[model samples]
Target chain A: METSCHDALLFTAEHPLRLRSGATMAEVSVRYETYGTLNAERTNAVFICHALTGDAHAAGRRPGDKRPGWWDTLIGPGKPIDTDVWFVVCPNLLGGCQGTTGPSSTNPATGEPYGLDFPLLAMSDFVTVHRRLGEHLGIERWAALVGGSLGGMQVLEWILTHPSEVDNAIVIAASSRLTAQNIAFSAVGRQAIMRDPEFRDGAFQAQGTSPDKGLSVARMMAHITYLSEDGFQSKFGREAQSGELGHNFGVDFAVESYLEHQGNSFLSRFDALSYLYLTRVMDYFDPFATPDATAALAADPAKVLVVSFDTDWRFSTEHSRRIVRHLEGARVPTSFREISSPWGHDSFLLTIDDYHRTISAFMERAAA
Target chain B: METSCHDALLFTAEHPLRLRSGATMAEVSVRYETYGTLNAERTNAVFICHALTGDAHAAGRRPGDKRPGWWDTLIGPGKPIDTDVWFVVCPNLLGGCQGTTGPSSTNPATGEPYGLDFPLLAMSDFVTVHRRLGEHLGIERWAALVGGSLGGMQVLEWILTHPSEVDNAIVIAASSRLTAQNIAFSAVGRQAIMRDPEFRDGAFQAQGTSPDKGLSVARMMAHITYLSEDGFQSKFGREAQSGELGHNFGVDFAVESYLEHQGNSFLSRFDALSYLYLTRVMDYFDPFATPDATAALAADPAKVLVVSFDTDWRFSTEHSRRIVRHLEGARVPTSFREISSPWGHDSFLLTIDDYHRTISAFMERAAA
Candidate 1:
């Protein structure tokens, strides 16, 4: 997907997070990229949350030309998120690399990237920032909050915490909470990132070059989870990319290339600190962790549409079912479907139509 | 489980193959471990094949140790494989770590480990070695050839190459051939090994310490594939093993500890040279590549029992289906089932009674 133009105003929290220290009360602002025209009513603002390694540069032209947009197929003129009629805003999360005050952001006090020293934030903190951004835009409520996987987690929390803030919530191929194993996976990733001596307790910003190896490994690990065994086999079964191996580990399968690309490119566009933060947000994100848990949350699934891919092992259909059960319990209008795909968790990014149409219909009802 | 030192009996081979490097051999020799006594007719031999890093220590008590065998409960006197009536033999493969002529084996010409200079082998080569071992043991045929994942791959190739050699083939959590993606994963592991400067082109046998980091990373990578997303989420989602990460990459999650244990312990027992050799065997295995092309070699699918666990992603159940479909087309007697498990590919190794019973029924019929 092409990235947006280089121009965008950024802001950070008045008080920066004091991570590693374990004390709270740290604040950080976010960097955001916006496209499409904001209507006079300001009622058309739609905030989009990105996947694990995604950024505010959803789509545009020429990769940085500032014309098209990320999620271009679904966000421009006549597209699903139709820029022609709606205003779209995406922020680099608190721990993201884009323009937000994340691990990559320079710590005002020391003028260094906050690497590991960034305060550990709850998933709700992300929603809180979205709320602030919404307030800054002078929008009382969101027309829709659309996201997939981790992004979907935000959408879920948004609807739950700020129930009246978003009119429609579209969560795709995402789970309601972190499973123990998912938490374990994230723990390993964080370990990988933290283990890289160069990580230097989150002060790697001045180093310019982050823990590319550890980050790549973390990405590679995450990449593995995003796909189902069936999907992985169907797409990349034991065939060497070149029928023969020089016997080195650069990547000998098309899938390895895909994973490597994901791992490597992510380092360029996303922050490792952000990666740790977001995964943590996801891990600590059990909507059913509180009073009465599932039953209580089930009664509060706000006008939601949950979509899952059969091939997505990360948030398999089972996760979707849990959300559906909650929504069904809440008696909130809900649509749940498990699309068959061999693309794994990535199915959400590629299959624009099925989901686009689902959301389109969903928004129609929400707006009415 | 504790290992027992059997009498160290020497065995014979059935199809002693000539080495591609030009050594003509009449029969192959085998050093093995057995459990349970053979029945009067000697028809209940259940041959167990080990995975890439596995040893011939499948079941029963060690010579003097208290720890049960690796596959103890499943193969003891009255266990599933029924050591009471069936004879079980697990032979260390040709390019294996345990008591086999592998990379660790000294080269006859140079009087050093085969290392990188050793001839590369395919899955067929490993199977051929196993066949030789079978012949040497005075065993005409096995009642059942049982294995999981890589071991399962051997089982599949064994039946394809010598269709009638084994009456029953129980392939668990494995595919007919490594998918391109599978090869890619293994390639990553191999790269981790050989890419290490210390690897010294697998000649690291003389280099004091092998590529421990690379090998550990490789093992970690493989370990992820061994479990299902559900299994991972249930076990280690993002929770810090220490409640808070010193967060760099030193094993923050219990899963990381588990993986590190696997990786580190593997290096202690497994020779890195053989690791490269055997992994290649798995990668080069393409039974269907030429078999589907040539008519004479088109195998009559032997009686096969292919089992898959819902959670085992390494050799996803879909892989099992690919094998079953090929066998079905070839008119080979095959039975396929997807057992429910959250353990992923490891389920094939962990699930006891269910898998054992499946093998029991399948082997009983084959012997009959």
Candidate 2:
């Protein structure tokens, strides 16, 4: 149940990291966490791709930490992920604010935070960094790649671009191509951040101010999408925060207070520029649009499992079905399931019986 | 089909209007538009309530105007509401921006725009002003009260508070109590406006600067909800604005471009203070929560038709169903219809064949 952090200098001047946008990073450092132990053959390693707003910490608590990882419920010894049998490695995404080389990182040339100067990223860039991290970890090939939401996008990208690198891919609540509505929501979030007076064109770091208001607004809005309407009704409903309406704009409903807390707490952990770049990465993600995207998977197809929550409007069951359809059309071994949960896109992070069982059964089959 | 605007001083210092918040408006004005002629009975008058962001104009083009009224398709001579047979009057709601007494209106006490000083309003306050407008029109009783979205809420309020005043009530795409998710969206929108530096504590008019960015962002987010997923997919989808990704953040996808256009265009027409007050009014709307809310309708019920579009996630069919259940429980005559449309909550505003036909048939029955 223990997890340890690992920071590796993955890319340097001699081995610069090239982004999908044609920009190169002279130095790239990856911060990751590992749970359990890799087997002797190094084939027992399962690459975990964290979703938006997620970090390298995938399971168990670090020293002195009060809470375990974000997905701690489903990842541990004898759990669905079964850390006892397989090693789990999660890295902060390439353009992430968390302890990774992202927009907040210092640019080697200017020695200032990249801010808006950072190269625009795509899902491919994230997969590229992930592959380098795998190589750095001496993982010749991953036994499996597992992820949900944005993480799920990485798993699909790996299967599409380098199927031979992984034996199994678990894509949960992810879309091969974002719907127009999805893009619109992400666009609004980006607009919120960019429009903040303190944003200073994403160079707020140099100005000693942050686009906290804008970032908070963006997070609050996105947080609403992460939960199901039924979930919200059950949890908050018309419940007044102080037993009566605030009458003014402070916080009348429990839902508003909850969102305010979510927004405020997010500012302390997330960077505004990183939010912009990472969301942009998801916005432009159109892997299936690429001609012959699955042609590579045809040769050494990875066993794929696409999972979606029934109530997940963010990336609905249709999104997973589309991914399954594409994989099946490519003659790849694929399984799809729509788990019943009231949690929406966030159900992937929770310990729902059916969802965990599906993953557990799939992992067992893949591992065998 | 001709529509002429009418502005009336509905309240004065001699007879001040009392608000739900116990505040008094010494002076209040109502802006409305009338289509067709009132019959000798006066009961032939049909009062139309406009939704959020709507104005007094409901049908026909005014002098020197390029566009007809908002509901021109449904309110013309031979259209759903049939102007030739029924005199239709559409009034701007109480706390509205378009020539109505609202948060943006001047407070006689302060001699400045009310802004945040505007009293917190409820659905009852809107209904109170609406009733005054009805009386001022010299109509003893309305043949029908028709509305959609927030307008629908007003119709419901009329049924609950003044059932004897209207023969029929058609409420479309409204909720008796906003779900937590609904409130969450409104709360984020308010946050977006309030967080803007230009807001200046809602006294932006005094400062000669508007929260244009914040208001635009709010509009962009709400515009997404006003549309169904299928509508966005068909209308904009992931199609690039310029046939290629911009790669940076300035309108890459067609949806983003469309949303930006919507947001930008909204700034010139809508007031931030009004947006705040009106959305708050909706958030606090819980008519059914009041004791024996439908008791007044028990004695002389207004024939009610509650309509909802299947694709409307904002106020889904469940909202309409809830209204019907409440009315039915109180022995009020009510009919319900779940119309299928790709337009989502905005479906009520669109001229869908089934929707129009349903309204037309109901109007005929109500007139009979």
Candidate 3:
């Protein structure tokens, strides 16, 4: 496996970024990491986009880090992504708290954290940032783009926004647009953060406080959506945590304990305001809303592969089907397969032999 | 349709009741409503159980109310349950706040509201109370027992604990036990309430406060689980509430507005403590956990019908399948059917023709 190191790229005032929400920000910077070597033609570069709550650290371990990166299972030299065969680039999206210019970032104009003042983001903005990052890395055109969930949404944006930049695009466990249920979940999560007294209108940083409870609640809710009912059954199965009920409002079931641990651990690594902004961006994503939308895009048939998990109710197989249907209607030769898995929406991140094989074969053919 | 009126049934100290959690209460009171008349042979009594957040008012409206009961659609004179033909009884569950003895009820020992002091409950406790109500009504057994969700759990208890009393049991969108996902959601909901400072260790009432925000967030999270992705898309469809994105955390999408409305409206009608207690009872329900569980039960196999909705992910059709499997393993004659609908877990309460027909035909046969 090719070892990777984190790198930061600064987009100075000259590269002032304008967001879809009619807001603009200057001095943008994105943190990214890369593995393997870019070919002489720069045609073997594979961009790996991260989902919500993910970062530039897609694979491999950071300095002194005992645990490997989030996507280490699938992104190593001998793994499905096969870093030895292709240069893999993973960038933390804008509005992310992980070494990216987000709400926690200082506003050049005010010399303070952007907080609520941070301009709203769209998936296109992330793609735009990625484009700048790609240009900085001396990659004019890449071999392929791959992402799952929010990252998948970004992959779609990259194809629609800059079709000629990549040869193949793989969207895994994502939707063309977030459905009402997705938005509703995001809404509750945002409301939970906003209603937390410590949230303080997304400016809790000034008070040196964190909306830990609200953010924990949000993560708890989301963590449930990421697992299948079968997964939950096989993992927790109504097992009591303390051998006896607390007989009060305390953690009684093993699932509750797991959720609390997930929620609490998330608070240590994530920013509450960024959770708000990023989830909103997902809710606002819809490419086909414009007039002559699909027709207006650079129609490149045989350039897209869509994948879904059978048990992924969060962004179920139907969502992937809808995306494929949209691509087909636009005359794009799209290949889609719903892989069987009990991991729900998180199947893309897990080690499923069939899932890995499909992705490997697809990537191999795309490279060929 | 025959007009119905609400009635209260009180059990004084002479009728002291013990609960499954080793807690006992005196002067326990259960509110109920009846439609039609008990048959001459006392054999046509049909008991309808309400799920979480439900009450004794299962059908018809109060004296001056404009809206009918929640289940009024299927419980009317000429409707599916056919109140005109069968004697129908609906009682508020023991841990419910709808004029029933619950966390909001006054504690005989403390003389204050039970609140956190209220003992935890199990499905059997609700059944025991209903049995007392039945004895009070001079009805030896019910011709049929029908319920959905938590109500379905209670119906299972009725058959398992007092098998001879329920000639027919119909479980709708229910599970024999909650899976990890269900418990995770309930855990988040409970944490939302408990973390609210106003909850004050469940003594909010004493401080003249209500954990409205926490309770509301709980409701919002549960509401998402109650609807299918298709149902949400058709209903809300990423429509912007203000004609444009607020670009802030304020209600931007129509789904957010709708969920906020639901959460807010729920606050006025429900007690936070009751929500906590009832959800715990649901989390604790598991009939097959005991040794000799199936053989110990007085097995009357020919009297059970398990109904599920294809789109109900909260208590998905798989959960219903599990219940049917258990029943079959116990040599119980059970009919299981999965009806297609886009309403998700709420299909049982919606105007789905297939769902209503299944229940109607099953109940009719059960009564005969």
**Winning model by lDDT:** 2
lDDT score, candidate 1, position A35: 73
Q: TM-score each candidate.
A: 0.83, 0.98, 0.93
Order of candidates by lDDT, top first? 2, 3, 1
lDDT of 3 at B129: 89
The stretch of ten residues in a row with the least summed lDDT in candidate 1 chain A is: A1-10
lDDT tens per residue, model 2, B23-140: 8999999999999899887879999988889999889998887888888879988898998899998988888899989888889998899888888888889889988887888987
- Model 3 chain A poorest 10 in a row by lDDT: A293-302
Score chain A of each prediction against the true chain A by TM-score and list the results.
0.86, 0.99, 0.96
**TM-score between model 3 and native:** 0.93
Better of 1 and 3 by lDDT: 3
DockQ of 3: 0.70
Instruction: Say which docking band candidate 3 falls in.
Output: medium
Clashes of each: 55, 0, 1
The alpha-carbon lDDT assigned to residue A193 of candidate 2 equals: 92
Off by over 4 Å in 3: A1-9, A38-43, A242-248, A291-302, A328-333, A366-368, B1-10, B39-43, B242-248, B292-302, B326-337, B362-368
The sequence of per-residue lDDT tens digits that candidate 1 reaches over residues A302-365 is: 5678989887767778999998887776676778878777788888877446667876677667
Model 2 CA deviation exceeding 4 Å by range: none
Pick by DockQ: which candidate is best? Answer: 2
* lDDT tens digits, residue span B1-368, model 3: 45554545556677678888787788678888888888899988989999998888888877787888889988988788988788999988887888888888889888899888888887888888889888888999888999999999888877876777778889999988778888888889999988887899999997899999889999999999898888988988878887776666788788888899999999988999999889988887788877656663445543899999998988988889988887788888789889999889988888889888888898878766
